[model samples]
Target: MLSERQQLILRMIVEDYVHSAEPVGSRTISKRSEVSFSPATIRNEMADLEEMGYLEQPHTSAGRIPSQKGYRFYVDHLLHPFRLTPQELFQLKKIYVDKIDAMERVVQQTAQILSSLTNYTALVLGPQVHENKLKHLQLIPLSDRTAVAIIVTDTGHVENKKVTVPEGISPDEISRFVAILNDKMRDVPLQHVKSKLYSEIMSELNRYMNQFEGVMSLLDQIVEVEQEDRVYLGGTTNILNQPEFRDVEKLRPLLDMLEKNRTVFQLLSQQDTPGIQVRIGLENDLEQLKDCSVITATYHIDGKVAGTVGVLGPTRMEYRRVIGVMQQLTELLSDLLTRLHR
Candidate 1:
C-alpha cells in the first residue's frame, strides 16, 4: 500500500518512462499540473518508492524508472482506460465490413492491422479444429486408381487428401458410397469421423464393395485430428525498431522463437481465462521473453474459446493503448469467427 502522493508520483514516473524509454526525475514529476508538491518532496517519495521495490535507478543519475513491480502496481491499481480515437475504431471496423469470407484471411489481416497500428509484434492463434463438425464431404475419381477426398467443416475450413482408388470400386459405386457417407456422417465432429465411419459406414459399404477394408483405411488417415495449434505472426521485424533491441545479440533468441510457429503458438496459448491477460517481464515463464511483455486475449467461435491473440513488445510497452486495442480486436474477432462458423 502507498500514500496518495506516493502513488501519484509512481504513476507519473511509469507513464513518462514508458513513453520516453528514459528514467524520470523529481523535477519531471513535480512539474505535472496535478502535482502540487515541491521537487525535494517528490524526490523523498521517489527514494521511498525505490526502497519498496517499485522503482529502480539505472545509474548515479538523479532520475528513476519503474521496475517490474512498479509496472504491476500501475496495471493493477493506478492504470486508467485509454480511449481510442474515432479513426482507430473506424479502421478496425472496416476489416469486417469489407467482408473477407475466409477465416484464414480474416485472421491474417487482423494480425497485420494490429501490428501496423501498434508497431509491435502481433500474433493470432488459429482455431484448433479438433472438434469442428463436418459440413460436407466429397470424393472425386481422377483416374482408375486415384481419387481425391475433400472435407469441409462448418467453420468454412477445407482439407483435401489424395488417395489411391480401391482396385475394384467403380465410379458409380463411389457415388453411392458418398451418398451413404453424407447421410450418416454429416455434422459429425472431425475427431469422431473415423470412428463413425468404421462402425457405421463400413458395414454398409462391405455388403456392396469388396474393397471396403482399403477404403476405410484411407478415410482414417484423412480425418485424423491435428495435434498442433497454428500460429500467425505479423510485423516480426518490428522488434528491431525498438530502442531496447538494437543489439542483434539481445534480439536473436526472440526472433528465433518467433520464426518457429510452434514456439509462438505455445507462448500465446498459455492463457486459458476469458479476458485479456498481461504478463510483464519475469512473469512470463519463458526465458526468451523475460525482457518483454505479452498481452493475450482468447477469441471465441460460437461462444466457445477457439483461439487466442496477443501483442508482444518490450517490457516498456504502452499497456493502456495496447490493452484497449487487444480488447476491442478480440471482441470483433470473436464476432467474426462466430459468423464464419455459422
Candidate 2:
C-alpha cells in the first residue's frame, strides 16, 4: 500500500512518461502537474515510490520511470474508461456502415478503421465455419475441364474457388452433379460435412449411371479447403512509429512474429476467460513481444465464439482508450453479425 501523496506522485510520473516518453524528475512533476507540494516534498514521495518498486531511476542524475509493476497497477486501478470523441465515433460508424453488405470488405475495412483510429497495429481473426450454416451454393461451369465453386455462409460470407474437373467429364454431367450437391449440401454447416455424408452422397451419385464419381471428388476438395480459418492483419507499419520501437534490432523480431498468423492465433485463442483480456510485458511468452502489450476481445456469432480482434502496441500504450475502443469494436461486430443472421 502507498500513501495518498505517493499515489498522486506515481500517477503524475506515469502520465508524464506516457505523453513525453521520457523519465520524469520530481521537480518536473511538481512543476508540470501543479500538485500542491513543494519540490522537496515531491522528491520525498518519489523516493518512497521508488522504494515501493513502483518507480525506477535509470541513472544517477536522471528522473524516474514507472516500472512494469507500476504500469500494471495503473492499468488495473488508476485508469478510467475512455469515451470516443464524436468525430472518432462518426468516422468508425461511417466506415462500418458503408461496407456492411460484403463480409470480407466489412472486416477488412474494420481493421483499417481500427488502425487509423488507434494508430496501432490491428489484427482480426476471420470467422470460423463451425457455427456458420451454409446459406447458398452455386457451381458455375466454365469449360469442359473447370468450374467455379461459390459458397455463401449464414453470416453473408461468400467464398469462391476455381476447381479443375476430372478427366473425361462432360458439361451435362457436371450440371447434374452440381444439382445433386446443391440438394444435399445446402443449409448444413461446412464443418459437419463428414466422410459418412460424403459416402452417402457418392452412393446416390453412383446410381446415376456411375457418372458423378469425379464430381464427388471435386466437392470433397472444396469442403476440405473451406474448413481452414483465416487471420487478417493490418497496420504493421504503425508499430515503427512508436518511440518504444525506435530500435530496429528490437523491432524486427516482433514484426516477424506478427507476420506469422498461426503463432498469434494460438496465443490469442488460449485466453478463454470472458470479456476483455490484457497480457502485459513478459507475460506474453514470446520473447520478441516481451516489451510490448496485447489487448484482445473475443467476438461471437449466435452466442458462439467465431473469432478474436485485438490491438498490439508498446507497453506504454494508452490502456484506457485502447480498452474502450476494443470493447466497442467487439460489441459493434457482434451486433453487425446478429443483424446479418436476421
Candidate 3:
C-alpha cells in the first residue's frame, strides 16, 4: 500500500522506462512528468520503491528500472485500456470481413495481422477437434503396399496421411474397406470411435481371412496417432528488434521453440481459461520464455471455446495497445466463427 506520492512516482518511472527502455532517474522523472516534486524528494521515494521490490537499479551510476514486481503492479492497477485509432479499426474490420469465409485462412491471416499491428510475434492455435465427429473417410490406392488415407472432420478440417496397406490386399478390397469404414464411422465422434466402433470393424474383419487382421492393426494405428491441431505463427524477426532479445545467443532458444508447432500449442494451451490471460516474465512455464510476456485471449464458437489467439513480446511490451488489439481480434474471430457455423 503505497502513499499517493509513491504511486505517482512509480507510475512516472514505469511510463518513462517503457518509452525509453532505460532506467529512470528521479531528475529525469521530475523533468518529464507533470508531477511537481523536487529531485531529492523523488529520489527518496525511488529508493523506498527499490527496497519495496517495485524497482531496481541496474548499475552503480544508472537510474532505476521497474522490476517484474513493479510491472505486475502497474499492469494490474495503473495501466488503462488503450483505444485504437479509426484507421486501425477500419483496417481490422476490412481484414476480418474478407478472410472470415475460410477457417484456415482466417487463423493464418489473423496471426499475420496481429504481428503487423503489434510488431510482436503472434500465434493462433487451430480449433481443438478432439471431440470432432468424422465427416468422411476416403482411401486412394498408391501401390499394393501404400495408400493415401483422407479423414474429414465435421468442422471442415481435412487430414491426409499416406499409410501402409497390408500385403496381398487388392485395390478393390481396399476400396471396399474404405466404404465400409466410412459407413460405420462417419458422423461419429472420434474420441469414442476406438472403443465403440473397433469391435464392429473387427467382427467384419473376422468374416475374412486371418490375413485381414493386419488391416485392423492399421486402423488402430491411424486412430491412435493423435490428431494435430493447426497453428499459425508470424513475426519471427520482431523478437530480434526488442532490446531484451537483441543478443542472438539469448534469443536462439526462443526462436527455436517458436519454429516448432507443438511447443507453441503447448504454450497457448497452458492458459485454459476462457478469456484473456496475461502471463508476464517468469510467470510463463517455459524456461525460454522467462524473459518474455504473453497475452492471450480465447475465441469461442456457440459459447464453447474453439481456440486461442495471442501475442508474444518482451516484458517491456506495450500492454495497453497489444491487449486492445487482442480484445478486438478475439471478438472479430468469434463473430467470424459464428457466421461459419450458421
Q: Which candidate gets the maximum lDDT versus the true structure?
A: 1
User: lDDT values of the candidates?
Assistant: 0.84, 0.77, 0.80
Instruction: List, residue by residue over 259-295, the lDDT tens digit for candidate 3.
Output: 8888888888877778788888999999999989899
Candidate 1 ranges with C-alpha deviation above 4 Å? 136-150, 160-183, 208-214, 225-229
Off by over 4 Å in 3: 32-34, 167-169, 181-186, 192-216, 221-229
Q: State the displacement of the C-alpha of residue 122, model 2, in Å, after optimal TM-score superposition.
A: 0.7
lDDT of 2 by residue, 1-342 (tens): 777778778878888887788889878977864588898998888887888888899876569988888888887778776788888778677767875675556666667777877888988776775556667778787887788888787767777888888887777777776676567866778777555356566567676635556766776766654322466777989999999899889999998898787877776776665578888787788898888888888887677777778889988887888888988788888777666656
Question: Looking at candidate 2, what is the lDDT of residue 284?
Answer: 86
Least accurate 10 contiguous residues by lDDT in model 3: 220-229
Q: Can you give the TM-score per candidate against the true fold? A: 0.88, 0.85, 0.87
Ten contiguous residues minimizing lDDT sum, candidate 2: 221-230
> Which pairs clash in model 2?
none
Task: Evaluate model 3: give its lDDT.
Answer: 0.80
Rank order (by TM-score, best first): 1, 3, 2
Give the RMSD in angstroms, all C-alphas superposed, for model 2: 3.3
Identify the superior model by lDDT, candidate 1 or candidate 2: 1
Q: Which lDDT value does model 2 have at 227?
A: 29
